[model samples]
Target: MSSMTAPHPIDDQWDRFRSTLADASQLLLCLDFDGTLAPIVEEPDEASPTPENEAALASLVSASAVSTAIVSGRALADVRDRIDGPKTYAGNHGLELSRHGLVAVHPVARKRTSRLEAVCTALETVLEPVPNCRIENKRLTGTVHVRSVPRRLRPVVRRHTHAVVDRFGNDALEVSTGKRIFEIGPSIPWGKGNAVALIAADLPSETVPIYIGDDVTDESAFRIVEPDGIGIRVGGDEPSAASCRVESPTEVATVLDWLGSVGVDLLESDTSELSSVDTSSFE
Candidate 1:
């Protein structure tokens, strides 16, 4: 596994990252909710962004050169409600997206909602006897969380979860593992990478894409932005396409705070330049 030293405010590495963003005509700042913006918690519903993090995001959103979006595994409305802002949101692992009063759902994913729900039901029943296993119904997808399950019983949990998913046939649905959780979603080519690509397609040609996340699912997005953009992994030494790393959500906030400050300065500079433009010729 590749590892990076913990990021600090005065780190030269962070300064270089800021320099990249400083020259971009537009910045597409994509973030993951659970582990990137907020610390991972025992209860998914209890996770919320800190005040400092929220302030940073607010500044980024208000910046003329930046477009902020939250791409999360939670349901679109659920994550949107948790973060108090009017930025873009891609939820359900990007199976669903909402931006600027417009919403889009993958047709293929929509078709499997019923099957996913059925799988969720079967997994719930099959794993009910297992302690500390929680079934999260994400509408278009479902997750069997084993983080709190006894380590010895995790194998059994995985077995049962796999059995339930396999019963639906591999073509009907697929299972993906993350941290200590298993997710059941449609067996489609779409993922966070596809979602980020879709979002980036609408931005200016000079826009620089930046994705921050921590999970197996986020690897897809990291690969998507590689070679051309920045991907910052939060709290994991596992092999990943992300080029940089931050120790925890606190460091993630520090990064955001820095980006926000730079974005604000850029916006102000643009305003000042416009104010100085000689408009006398137009009159």
Candidate 2:
């Protein structure tokens, strides 16, 4: 019998990684809010990053050579309120973005706002009797959270969620699953990948994009960063498009610390060779 070994931790690759950051003209550090920065909590409102991670992020944000961004399923305002310092934010799975002083919402996503609201209302009515089922109405997207629902009633929750999605018409809205949640957003071509690409367009030519996320939805971003950047997945045993994996939010903090150190070193030295990493294997 043959067995597969566990994926190597992202920290193990530091020797091969620091040079990429040191050499880049700019560094775009994109992160997912909930699982990647803060520990996943049963109540969404309770999620917050640890003090150490918060300080690390603040340091990175303050660094002149690095630009920090948060890409999340939460609303743009919500994520902005959660994370103290990031140069840019992409929220509602990239349906909305806010950077510098400009904010943009997808025209197509805006068109489905009424539809999303109606679905949330319908889901609220249908899931009322099902204990622990909560409906969150984000402006660009809505999510039905079943994390606290009894396991036996999970199937019922899924059934009702599907019925609501069907009632709204799949062409107008689509359903996507996340950890213990079902998200309903406009069925458009936009996603995290498109958001990252858009953000990258404004960056310098040699900007190294580093994306860290922990969800099925994050796979799109992983693909985007594979070509010339680093894609890190947090807390999963399954095969993912991400080139590296960190075990949990604690490990994610460690990575953030490493990045903070790299940023500080690069700023202090300001004379490292501008070398590029071979990204062919990631492709």
Candidate 3:
């Protein structure tokens, strides 16, 4: 899962999402970082999933009929570093897709590295006058890192990013805004939703997809899903495309625990129902 623009209640919404997973033949747990699992940080590199969240997700993945993915707009390696190499990582929207044993590289990325390089070049030139600002190349994206910059300079930074990218091409590159972080990337039509949809069909069975995320980038996941699939937005007290919302990353973990519980409940209930049924009649 990716992120969204607005905020919504991510807590107290677990039951709303349980039907999507109850009795599901398979469950795909798709998640986002930065406000979803890990709280946003001044330094992107410093953002790490809390040990509890990691352990919970690890446990869920180990459970039968479940798979996991950490999808983020952050570069693949960077996300890998944070989650420490979880299976099924999709980085830079859907530009890079990888699982432990399989990998899919977007063809556009091969032709588009230079475009990112060009954006970096332009960023270096445009941001030269702005002190306390840094331009970063994530290979697939360019971030005008202003985390260290004073709040007053944000407008100046945003203006410079728009001006530089406008110099050439169409909307082939994107500028995404996050908590004090603004990024530009190749204008490609891929994102978390696309990743989730692709991964969903490839699972061994037709599974329920539950996406968890916080950020505008995550809206991609919020938009794509079948009738049985669910998008769990992690943020504010407002409404969104996501069927339900939770308040924080901790709540996300809580909801996941709830999902595990639901699966257990379903298994137990099925067992009890079967026990009550007389099998000799059919035999």
lDDT per residue for candidate 1 within 113-208, as digits (tens), equals 888888898888888999889999898989999989999999998888888888874577899999889988999888998888888876766678
Worst 10 residues of 2 by lDDT: 274-283
Best by TM-score: 2
Determine which window of 10 residues in candidate 1 has minimal summed lDDT.
1-10
Task: List the candidate 1 regions with Cα displacement exceeding 4 Å.
Answer: 1-12, 263-283
Q: Which pairs clash in the backbone of model 1?
A: none
**lDDT assessment of candidate 1:** 0.80
RMSD of each: 5.6, 5.9, 7.0
TM-score between candidate 1 and the true structure? 0.88
Q: Relative to the true structure, how large is the alpha-carbon lDDT of every model?
A: 0.80, 0.83, 0.72
Instruction: Write candidate 2's Cα lDDT for 25-61 as tens digits.
Output: 6788899988889999999999998777788889889
The segments of candidate 2 whose C-alpha lies over 4 angstroms from its true place after superposition are 1-7, 263-283
Q: After superposition, how far is residue 155 of candidate 3 from its true place, in Å?
A: 1.4
Our tally of clashes for model 2 stands at 0
Clashing pairs in model 2? Answer: none
Residue 109's lDDT within candidate 2 is: 91
